[model samples]
Target chain A: GAGVSQSPSNKVTEKGKDVELRCDPISGHTALYWYRQSLGQGLEFLIYFQGNSAPDKSGLPSDRFSAERTGGSVSTLTIQRTQQEDSAVYLCASSPGLGPITQYFGPGTRLTVL
Target chain B: GESVGLHLPTLSVQEGDNSIINCAYSNSASDYFIWYKQESGKGPQFIIDIRSNMDKRQGQRVTVLLNKTVKHLSLQIAATQPGDSAVYFCAENLHSGGGADGLTFGKGTHLIIQP
Candidate 1:
């Protein structure tokens, strides 16, 4: 079975620029989540999407962070006006449904805001 | 705010030995817990999970124990191997009024296996 997949394994961008990270969840996964991991740090919740319903954006640190999922499948996380603090690995995961279900993750996109 | 924390930042164990990683979580309302393993350069993978209703669950060579009364969780690995060396995280899910709630992750524990 195909696992979750992410685009641009590595991205280097200048400060104040915007970057979009993509994620493709498994074929039948109805729940998708995005998280950020800084070096030597734990994973931080970013956002979650379920089917075609509105995403849970509570974890978005600021208005500069936004994410959207289309057709209940692929998702894109966009960071506006990137700062040095935004440099980290963006991870995407998908689960069969909701709570208690195990999630499968992608390789992640390492975004470096220089 | 509730917090999930690890007792140790790193644990070194010899191959074929049992490994135990401990975690303490706040928020008595939390009903589900999970453990994930992430290797360098890779995203996290689910190792096992335990629900609030149960005290323990086993999967292959891994076992997860949850103590709701104490807000504690533990993951035990049998016959540790070099392939098991990675960062392990414990996460909790609190039951909210709305849809699926977010997961709160604890500081990870780095497992190092010595052959």
Candidate 2:
């Protein structure tokens, strides 16, 4: 079966620029999540979406970060006015709707804010 | 305030030897734990998982041990191979009232296989 997929394997942008990273979850997956990983660090949760209710933005580092999942399938994470600290790999994952289910991850988009 | 952490940043084991990676978690409310492997340029792949009720679980050549009393978790790989070289992470999740939250991941341990 096809796994989760993300676009722009690598991205380089200037500080204060905005970037949009896309994610396509596996078919039939209802729960989607976005995470960030800095070099030599752990995965940091960003946001989560479950069948279109309000997304969980608790983990978003700041108000400049936002995400949207449309039609319960694809998701896009947008970082506005990116800062040097936002440089990291952005990863996307999806699961079968919750409760101890394993999440499938995408290759991720490496964002570099110069 | 709650976080998951690993004791070692790197581990080197000879091929055909066994490898053990340890993790510590601070959230007692976490009921599910998972291990993942991430190779360079790739996202994390799920390795194994165990619930709080179970102390141990086994996969093909891997075993996951959870000690809730000590908030410790370990992943043991038997006969480690070159392909096993990667960053291994331990994650904990709290299931609340049928809603699922994102996992909290440890800093990760880099496993190097020596031939």
Candidate 3:
């Protein structure tokens, strides 16, 4: 079966610009999550989207970071007015349902804010 | 064991030797723990997982141990190989009524395999 996939492998943008990263979870996956990883650091929780309820934005660092999972399939993470600190690897993961929390990840998009 | 803001801790081990990586989680409420292996230029790959109920679980060559008493978790790989060189991360999740809560990850440890 095809695993989770992400777009643009890499992205380079200027400061203050906005960038969008896409994620395609495996077929039938009902839960999606977005995370950020800094160099030599751990994965930081950003947002989570379940079947249909309101997304969990608690881990979002700021209002600029927003994500939307359209039709419960693909998810897009948008960073508005990006900053140097936003330069990191944006990773996406998905799970079959969610109760037990077993997730599979995508290759991720390395975003560079210059 | 665990790191704060500094760079990820490094564990150097010789090939064919057993390597054990440790993690100290902050949340005692977490009921599930997962270990992931991330190589350079790639996303994290799931290694093994353990639930709070069981103190230990084993995979092909990997074992995950969870100690709820001390809020600690450890991953032990039997007979490490060169391909095992990568960053290992321990993630914790508390089933907060919401089944799909985001995971809280530890700082991760970089494993260096030497021949």
Q: Which candidate is the best by DockQ?
A: 3
Worst 10 residues of 1 chain A by lDDT: A50-59
| DockQ (model 2, Cα) | 0.64
- TM-score, predicted candidate 3 vs. hidden true structure: 0.94
- Identify the CAPRI category of the predicted complex in candidate 1: medium
| Model 1 CA lDDT for position A11 | 99
Give the 10-residue window scoring lowest on summed lDDT in candidate 2 chain A.
Answer: A51-60
lDDT (tens digit, per residue) of candidate 1 on B1-115? 5389999999999999999999999888788899999999999998998888899999999999998888889999999989999999999887573654568889799999999
What is the lDDT, from 0 to 100, of the residue B10 in candidate 3? 96
Per-residue accuracy of model 1 over A37-82 as CA lDDT, tens digit each: 9999888988888885644677888999988889999999999999
DockQ, structure candidate 1: 0.63
Candidate 3 TM-score for chain A: 0.95
* TM-scores, each model vs. reference: 0.96, 0.97, 0.94
Error of 1 at B69 (Å): 1.7
Q: Candidate 3 lDDT (Cα, whole model)?
A: 0.87
Every candidate's DockQ is 0.63, 0.64, 0.66
- Give the lowest summed-lDDT range of ten residues in model 2 chain B: B93-102
Q: Which stretches of candidate 2 lie over 4 Å from their true place?
A: B97-100
